[model samples]
Target: MKKAKTISLNVGIALALFAVFLVPAASATTVSIGSTIVGEGETGVVSLMVNDVTDLGGVHVNLTYDASVVNVTALTNSDFDSKPNLYKRGHGWVLLEGGQYESGLSGSVKLCDVTLEAVGKAGESSYLNLTDIDIETFTYPPTDIPIDEVINGTFTIKPVTPSAKVVINEFEQNPPGDDSGNEWIELYNNDSTSVNIGGWKLINSGGKVVTIPDDTVIAVHGYWVANWTNGSLEDSNEYITLYNATGTEIDNTLTAADGNNDERCWARYPNGIDTDSDNDWKYQTSTMGETNGVPVAPVDTTPPTTNVTAPPTLWPGKPDETTIPSGTPLPWTSEPVQLWFFRTDNSDSGTGVAYTNLSLASESVADLVNVTISNNTWTWETNLSKGKNTTVPGTVGEYFNVTISEECNATIEYYSVDKNETPRVEPKKNLTVRIRFEIPFSEVTPGTRYTANVTHDLIEPANEGKDATIVFFAETATIDSKPYYVLDINKSVGGTEMYVGINETAENFTMKRLVMKNKTGKIMDLTFNPEYTMLNYPLWVGKTWTSTINVSGTVTYANNTTIPINIITTEIEAKVTGEENLTTPYGELRCLVVETNAGILDTGLSKPITITAKYWISADEKAMIPKYQSYINGNLTEELVLK
Candidate 1:
């Protein structure tokens, strides 16, 4: 029986030991220092966290960091009801201890919060090393709890980039009263810390500058108002700009024109909002030193009425007048002219006109002169002189002296009345007459007399009734020392009657002078120094020529101002390309196709003008008349056809 009892006791003891070996051990709590990212010159919070903890009564943590990167600002308990005791060692390390007098904290609780400030530059990091950590359970004498994990943290300093810390917030350009003492400008600082705006500048669009006084400091998110006494602001078309102490442009407001309402002001809708555009601003009532109000509609919608006073109108060689009709040409003179204008609002109580917009445009017309041939006549005259060498015609004789007078070149044909005999003249007399005819046809002065001696066979007694017949052929006439094959019968310019004669030679045709008479009995005479060549005669296929013309004169304006005009026209090319037949008012005629390109420059014009002209010329009349003509100036084209 004793041996059985011993065996039972041994078995029971072995079972008890086996049972104790099967039970699991408790898990250790984790204490970690939380990581964070903070901006430079900004504050951030770091937490001491306890994970998977139960029955926690007290905690103590020691953290270390690079002294140059961050600094501990303050410490506060988070999970515990009592505040933690914090001890900071310079800027490098910190120690925090906290405990609960009542029930201990449980799992996943924050011990305390550590406030830290980033003191280093951007892109710098500081390691938060958990050098020492201790945790206890809820017991009479705080039983120590095992901490298996102590996680370290880091503090990364990042750059703080704000769009604009200082901005132009609001302004009142047009006020209810005089703008000189009522205008004001407001500035705002949107930074996290105070900013010194000493030595800054504020400028208006009207060239008024105001410098800020010394030692001027603006608190964070603060405002500064500049009164009108500092600087003047225009009621309309105004803008303000702000610059830093270093003369760097920090902010500028959009150009604000006449709101037409004096009661409104220009301001940023959301205070201190800057988008750098006009869309960020609104027109509202004055909100000086306060938040802006909602935008309101304008009270006056009608535009102001205006009246313009012009200078005196005095045409050249005419009496002065008080007014000139609209569309009258104004003279561009040497002396400056003054024009006054008055503006008034439609309603007396409505918003007055802030400003008036005056724009000026100038238009000028070039003097154009055109010459055309109206009539081309060939004349033939017959005369007889006999017996004596006299100037009058008489009975038949052997020798006769005749005086022939003609404006142009003339050819005399003399023959016996009887066709049976041939006539002969003295050699010395014929040679003298032929030598006199050698002068240029154009140089032949009009109204000049010439003496011609003719000798013929004596007429028989039976043919006494027959006389020697002398015939003269005149192909052209001369007027004013210029030879003209055609005369101007009916001439007009711009539907006004005028006279334009064309002078020509066998080689080319030229325009010499044109005379015009206006309705007011004013005469305008224009003479070309080097006569303008209209055509190179003897037209054929593939013929080309070029010429230059200069027009210099003085034109008198309605304002009694005389302006000297100098115009130079350069013909780049003129070519006769081909031949064509055209039906015209005169008849169907064969014409030569002429193309001309020219550039014209005037002293009064801003730029040179180019012209391309096409003409269908009738080469038969020797006058070079065009049946069809077209002129192209820039994008405008004009055509003229024979009537």
Candidate 2:
């Protein structure tokens, strides 16, 4: 699939709502120090939870203890949401193991009565088995990485047996981009002693060997995980096999087996990321442990919350005004809202306030852009508020003040970027400038005609009553209308030369003619400059040339405005040679690629030099072919636009 377009608009929005505050909290001791001693069989469940009532989003708890003496049995549901509650029922476990575990194993255990247990007697130099804890927790050894605080869940553990020890954590698949190709696996150290997975091996279903870094280790009270990077070999829909240092297969996740998006996991910890076996590999929700035909259900009993605050305020700026140009529609609107009306200057003795003050109602504005935008009418009600009878001011300097307000919340709706306006420049007069072709597109080969639209302030010039003549000139001179020119020249079927059909206008009062030249001198052409004559000279119009020609002359009008008009001439080199290749757009034809080092052309890779024989078909099918185009990096820079 193609990547979504990332359009970056560098517009800054001043937020006036939600604010974030971080307050220093007094340190609280989680575990009663010196109360714990070392040894095994000293079964004890120590659970600590943080409950900030005012913050329903939940809070965090910091527990410190002697790892040598106490074993962390489990943690129940450790993810956070908007609710505040503690659960005694957990669905998973993490045990001390030699390697990672498969997430899809189904010998299930219930989680309602899950609890942390230390099974040894006191005063004995016993070890604490950190059981059923989150495999990716930073509280474990080498705790430098920051944990994602946005997640909340619980943890728990059980006594170590001689049987297999497996801890599993699953990551859900996100699609399109970073969502896909991202995965995780959790491993728990359910024993008192921290286990090192330095020489562990990770393999896939295809029996292919995989490499894992030797520095990886799972702390006594924590878990370990595997996150695939950009270059890792991962099955789009296959299983992953995990092995120990001795090349013994410890765990394997079956992909593509139970259909698409199925469970490829086995769990020791309950209430993990996903609960559905095929969709998410969460531990069984009922029984938690297997103890000599007896089922021991363990649960996590900790709760956490988050605190949030409101944002800052914004102050409105003073308004300004300006005169509406004549013929322009009065009472202009400022974008999505706020109608603008011109008023006489009541301030500074009729000099008028530089702008109008229309204190728009907050209901009439918006802070973000939305799809329901139209002309600046705030609402149907306020739109009717306009068109009211204008009062005839009794005084000369008195202003209309155009009362402006909104019937709806405008400021929160129609939010706009506030760019300070600069002072306007007055109009100039009696100046005539004749623009000629500095360069033509044909001179650049793989280029085309330059078309541009122009708009003028008709009211400003009309108010000044300045009678002026505006003309558009090509290579040829013309009368009142814009001048025209023939850019393409080719041999016609009638044995005559061809010319462009469009005409352009000129700017001078005198008339003249242009001459053409070529080194071969086989045919005469046009020159850039024509012999200039006064306005009284005989003016020639409607004349045609049969051979090579150049267009250059002077023009006149009733306004008497004048300027010199010149002919523009240039040469281009297109050395097309070679048989054309077949394409979907253009069929087979001859073409050639000519390399150039003249200017900013790319010389890195071979560039295309496509050419085609274009036939204008009157009835039969036309033969069309590809043309040359200039590209930079992988983007089109210029191309020949055939008319």
Q: Local distance difference test, per candidate?
A: 0.54, 0.28
Off by over 4 Å in 2: 1-168, 171-176, 179-181, 207-209, 230-237, 256-280, 283-643
For model 1, residues 1-643, the per-residue Cα lDDT tens digits are 9999999999999999999988866766788888889778888898888888888888866566766788888877688866565532423555666778889889798877888899889878777766446788878887888778888888998865664488888888777767777778888888888889999999888867888888898888888887867556776678889999999999999888655547678888877778777888988776787766445544453444443234454133433323233344444332222322233454533443322221111121211111110112211122212211111110111222222232211122222111111211111110001101111112223222211111111111222222221111122445457654321211122111112234444555554443322233223233444555545655556768876666554443434455555755444467887777776555676777877665656677445546555667764342234332324354333333443
* Candidate 2: tens digits of C-alpha lDDT, residues 1-643: 1232222221211122222224445432121101232235544333333222111221222122223333345544322322212321111112221111222111111111213444334443321212112212122232221222222222222333433333334332222234334444445454466766778766555555545678776665456666544333343565566677887876555363221233333343333222324544432322222211123332212111111111111102322433222222222221223322223222222221222111222332332222221123221111211111111111112222222232232222111111112322112111111111111111111222322111111112221222222112224545334343333221111010112222123321222222211222212222222322111101111111111122333322224333233443222122212223333233443232322111111232133212111111111012221232333233442232222
Query: Highest lDDT, which number?
Result: 1
TM-score of 2: 0.18
TM values, all candidates: 0.23, 0.18
